[model samples]
Target: EHKGAIAEAGGVKALVDLIFKWSVGGDGVLERAAGALANLAADDKCSMEVAVVGGVHALVMLARNCKCEGVQEQAARALANLAAHGDSNNNNAAVGQEAGALEALVQLTRSPHEGVRQEAAGALWNLSFDDRNREAIASAGGVEALVALAHSCSNASPGLQERAAGALWGLSVSEANSIAIGREGGVAPLIALSRSDAEDVHETAAGALWNLAFNPGNALRIVEEGGVPALVHLCSSSISKMARFMAALALAYMFDGRMDEFALIGTSSESTSKSASLDGARRMALKHIEAFVLTFSDPQAFSAAAASSTPAALTQVTESARIQEAGHLRCSGAEIGRFIAMLRNSSSILKACAAFALLQFTIPGGRHALHHATLLHTAGAPRVLRAAAAAATAPLEAKIFARIVLRNLEHHQTEPAI
Candidate 1:
């Protein structure tokens, strides 16, 4: 409330002005001024006000001009905080659009000071949400800088490790950037980071790997970097639901037939060993994927949804099984339809994963749950769910999740599309 009052009283503009005025010489006061803006920027209301009061431009100036590590760290942090106000704000684009902001932050990622490096990586990570900013950062050498950061920070603080991997993860969202990351010797570091005991570090690493795995070459790089077992470990053992989910997705993408030829790579015509290894990896991945699905299953709760069509039981199960953060994940109708098609896959493991992903998306209270449900409903997904649930060959977990998805769709049948 006091923070809100500060913004109301024009404190943000005053702070921005103070930073700019004192930043003339990289004075000690300028660092504190920028730090104050960073703190205020953590609040959504104040963050928007900061942008309105010209704080974005002011902070960018400080970041681009300040030579002191202390000032640079604070400025990058302010930029990151401004960029992270729970999303949907224009601050992200503002930061990216601020001339020299992305370059300055990218250069700061190479800072000798860990705090400066961490904050810069974080700023890049947040800004990469925008497509134009994402590619621009890569063009600014964000891919190489961040991959190097990821490699060198393995022994650094978890914050640095997480942010380093996160920056790469953000850039890897694009196919070109993903391929660039893999080719720039990023796969090995990310795989090593994925084995970190820190949940956030491993989670970010898994996310990057997931994005990179979209490219068959990168997927093969992950395999060659010994990422398969690491990803499988994350899918089975990570405490974070997002980590497990993305790890499962990464594994799915790897074994999803596109990498079939890559898995057959060998030095000579005598590639029997490679074929055997591929078969074993597939079985292991499928087994763990099935196990991941079953982890969310409670026979008693599922029995309730199975017994009646009412939403009470299904809602209860979804609530119990829901990953609250996953609700924030939005996908295109084509993406949702891909999972619907997967329900007919001959591989029961893929079918189960598809159902599991659908359940995650349509859990009712997610930011995009309604959007996903509408997409599924429009795509005629209910028919697929019914067939999947009734198929004798379907895994029990898949059958159960498919029924739950059907119930979720039914509950939304009368609601207006979001």
Candidate 2:
């Protein structure tokens, strides 16, 4: 009923003014006011209102200035709720950014009070959804702070590790931030979290590694930090679909251009060749390809699941297949058929991924694997590729790659019999 009264009385602005005015003098009044703002911000309509009236600034100030841990926690919660509201306006995130909320939130992440730390981490996780906010967090030294939080003892609350890893996952999206995270010695901690008993921590850590893998240099750093075996273990053992998905994504990134490294595993006679290590990673990846496909078959479903937990963009599906193809990983005819189906019915992203995977399968190194699968002739793959090449909405990279695949498929078909 109080919530309804607040909503009736000019909504979030009233709450913001009360918070600002009371926060200066009365601890009891400030806590109540911040708590009200947190509740109001949970409602999407009130979130935009809160941002418009400068409530985000008040919340950040309250969190920063409050001596009471409870007040700080509540203020952080309000900021997080506002950021998580997900209104198209993005005003909440913008206001928080302008108000210097990120720096305050980063400070809270280190608070001795566990509730304060958890709430601050959660708020940063929400704010990190904005690319600019991510850059700001990283620029403000949030990456090292977050990594320290995530590296806390195993007995620590799972929520702390989850939120810290999640924020790191967001920071890892930018190439420069990815390098910063590696430079801060974040890779080993993240890899360690992947082994946590808490599924959320495991999943979030995998996600951070996935994003970090986007930069080739970071990918190598991850590999050197023993990330490959850890990810492979998660892919094979985890019950959470998201965990397995992220594990596969991390592997894909780590091995993207290192196909020849894995290939060397089979032919090299030198006992000291890195092939032994590469071989284990390659076998694990090939073994889990079907699971990866199942996990990503419906991009929308996967995206929805991810957003429910961490509110980040989905991993590019094509990268997974491209890496597998680069390693000359073979697929069954049924799997090729699935790619054809995706080409026909999936979104442009998946279509491009499928087309490119088929393209790789036609290369000389990959051709022998497809001998048993008539994907080019019987499955109408060429028709799908040609259509994708001509589609208006297809990404230019997709279209060009599709055309190249079609041309190659045609050449393979028209060649004289030996």
Candidate 3:
């Protein structure tokens, strides 16, 4: 209420000015002023007001140079709120970068005060949403600092670990930062954090792994560090839908071209009595494929719900049912049609997963399965596959898989129907 009143009266500028003027004074005044700014920054209009009056610079300075931990904490929180506010112009992020805020935030990540560290890490996490700020933070040694903070204490508070891992997740978007994180030994800590008892830590760590896995070398490093089983475990059991989704994405990246493994498993089980077990494993794999297809089919809705910071209960239930249904059913024209539709999804992840699943149908036995089910002749499947294969935004691996599916489909088209 007070914050709304302050913004209504056009006192945000005055509050930001007071923050700068009172910083040299004792902690009480500085803390109060910073707190006020933090509250005001929560509103988009007031955040813009704060940014216009050079509030970001004042807050960054307090976070950097203030002797009082409380003041630093409040200032960092204020900067984080401003950076996270929905500003299409991204003015707060730009102002922060201009003020050299990344370096100071990186320094604060190492602060002895946990609150300060958490808030600073959160600020970095928000700043990292910008691609340019991502490069800036990475060059400022933010990746190494974040890795250190993530691993600072095995038993660190969840808030600290969550924000640190969240920052790492944001940083991992850059290929350079992904390589830097691996060089800094970031994989082991992330693997360790994925096993954290705290749900937030586990989710953020899984998310970081998802982003980092985009780099082949980093994916190999993560698997070498036992990330595969950890991720698999999270996908199977974690209550957080985001965690499960991220783990699945990491697994997808890890096994992008390894169709041979699926083939080997599908064919290796020769025991007559073990057929049920083989079927169960195949069903499980199908379930995962179906879940990915459904979730990424509409990326905008999924992103908005996930961005709300809510638990994954609704998504889990919806996707789980789809997975179960897909698992029970064999390859069908309807299923193939769904995969073809996913080829046109806005999300690269969805397009990639759909391509990967379709690739499975091109394998030796997989081709036979699709032929028997008449899934290859599903109307427009070939055309859609060709389009997705040539899509500019689809991942390289997705395009490759799509091209392979199209080649196989072309071969089938040339053959006379039985």
Which candidate number has the best TM-score?
1
Question: Which rank order by TM-score, best down to worst?
Answer: 1, 2, 3
lDDT of 3 by residue, 1-418 (tens): 7766787787887877787677677789889888889888887777888888888888888887888889989988998898886335575466456666888889988899999999999999988877788889988889889999988857778888899999998888777898899889999999999988788899989988977876667776776587766777787677776677667767665554332233333344544433454344434444564455454344554344334433343243233322221221134364466556667766566687767566555432342534723576656677788788677777655665566566556656666776
lDDT of 2 by residue, 260-331 (tens): 443443444753465566667656664564455444345553344334433132223333323332433334
**What are the TM-scores, per candidate, against the unseen true structure?**
0.92, 0.67, 0.67
* lDDT against true structure, model 2: 0.70
Which ranges in model 1 have alpha carbons more than 4 Å from their true place?
Answer: 86-88, 265-271, 307-310, 332-338, 374-380, 410-413
Candidate 2 lDDT at 66 equals 87
lDDT of 3: 0.71
Question: Where's the lowest-lDDT run of ten residues in candidate 1?
Answer: 262-271
* lDDT of model 1, residue 71: 87
RMSD of each: 2.3, 13.2, 13.5
The residue-level lDDT of candidate 1 at 298 comes to 80
